[model samples]
Target: MRSLTEEEIISHIPELSNVTLRKITKGYSFDLKYVTEWNGKNVLLRLYDLDLSERVQEKVEKMEAFKKLGVRCQDVYAFGEVPEENFCYTIFSFLEGEDGEAALANLTTEEQCAAGYEAGLDLNHMHELRIEASMKEHMAFIQEKFEKAVERYSRLDQQIPYGRKIIDYVRNNIRLIGESRLVFAHHDFHAGNLIISQKKYAGVIDFNRCGVNTAYSEFDKLELFSSRLSIAFSKGVIQGYFNNRVPELFWKIRSVHMAQLLIYHMNWVTDYFPKDLPQAKDAIQYVWEMYEGFHRTIPKWYEERQA
Candidate 1:
């Protein structure tokens, strides 16, 4: 990640009067800076990679749309393209809240349920936002991604049969999901993205991948978050968002999304993990569980979608 001199960041956004840069982290595509402004407000200045021009634009637009839909997120103070470095960046008001995961660990189940439900409510509102355009409108970008993923998985499946099952699941589902109602969705809505303050939901962050997409894609993420915590937590999240019931088709869409995550994990394990490590076997085992779950539930999912 390129370090933006305090001078460059301050030059781009004039609102930071008497700002002081406090910290910067590495190992990410973007640069994160915690700054203290002259006005006594804490703010975060996010500068994207030069290669992420399109993603930055999409994020800016999607954040505006989500705010219009009443989805809680960091308030954008100012954002636009910076000509000097040819990068897009945004300045946002600092939001202070414990991550939902940390909060979950500290709170009782009842409190966890409440926070999860609140997150769900916000997600529900987000999914209700009408998108005048279809995701296919970005076919040149999305279609090629899937095509390459499928081809890569085919080669990997020859080495580990689990990869084939995941490939098949995604092939069958991504197309069906495209046919779903295109609503604004936070593709990454895990506990990490949620913030809780004063024992209640405060905000959600990281809208970098937010867009008009399938409701199912979003649900899959929620499902994974729920699984990571507890069944009760998951139920709380589902009930909070769907009024105690999520449509079956929601799960079907989730199945496809989960399969995608699994494939990504497989690649990570393959490339990063030692070949004989137990970690590799565990990762593959998880994929099998996801496959079995989807297979057993697809008929019910179809019935729900039909209804």
Candidate 2:
């Protein structure tokens, strides 16, 4: 679909007909974000082609759940399909602050860690908001997913670092993957989607990848992205989430999840973000470097600090 003009957007959503609208171009979520005023109040409008009613419903349901749980996120105002324009739009309050990536650049390492710690607590709360369907159901799901990932990754052509070691490690540690209690994972918890205000965490954004899974899976991505930001931040998140008593079991499973990502991440980047190939490569290298440490589960950065 061709990009809709501001007039077209206003026509579809009458509330925005009289307010100012400026396009938000920060992230790559195909949805169009317009920072605009409505009824003498500023809000962000996210408009995307309405493909499936179920998809839109799921997103709004999760957003609503997050808001109720006291997780710092946008308060969704309205969501419905624009029949004439074939678009679905959701209007929500705009979080007033710089994105965490830019904000972290100006913050001290300790401050960044504080931001990460706050974000981590929020994530733990999100996971606590909902429980998994059933132990049997999740067991079956995790088994099938693990078998498929290993079978496919073992056959794939790309040569990632420690390929055999990771595969063997995954196969040997198969039981650990599904042992952790399942909860709703924000799947993409990182600095990029966070909002920083007054050198502190304001809120989190973008729950598009949210799902029901093991909570530890969230750390896999954070460890990758936070490595580029600050090791202290990454360590702080772990400490804060587990209340400064990090569990050995969490680390064991986190290592497995990160290993699985090495095999599967390329396909993700190729399909959704081809432009991010270089960054993806760097992330993969970072994973390899982390695994190089003597303690297989604990990341190298955290291990270095403890030493």
Maximum-lDDT candidate: 2
Cα lDDT tens digits for candidate 2, 62-109: 878988887888888888788777788888888999887788888887
Worst 10 residues of 1 by lDDT: 298-307
Task: Please report the TM-score between candidate 2 and the true structure.
Answer: 0.90
TM-score of each: 0.79, 0.90
Cα error, candidate 1, residue 112 (Å): 1.1
lDDT of 1 by residue, 141-253 (tens): 55567777666656653245556666776776666566566676787777777888988878888776676666656766454444455444555667788887777776666
Q: Score residue 26 of candidate 1 by CA lDDT.
A: 27
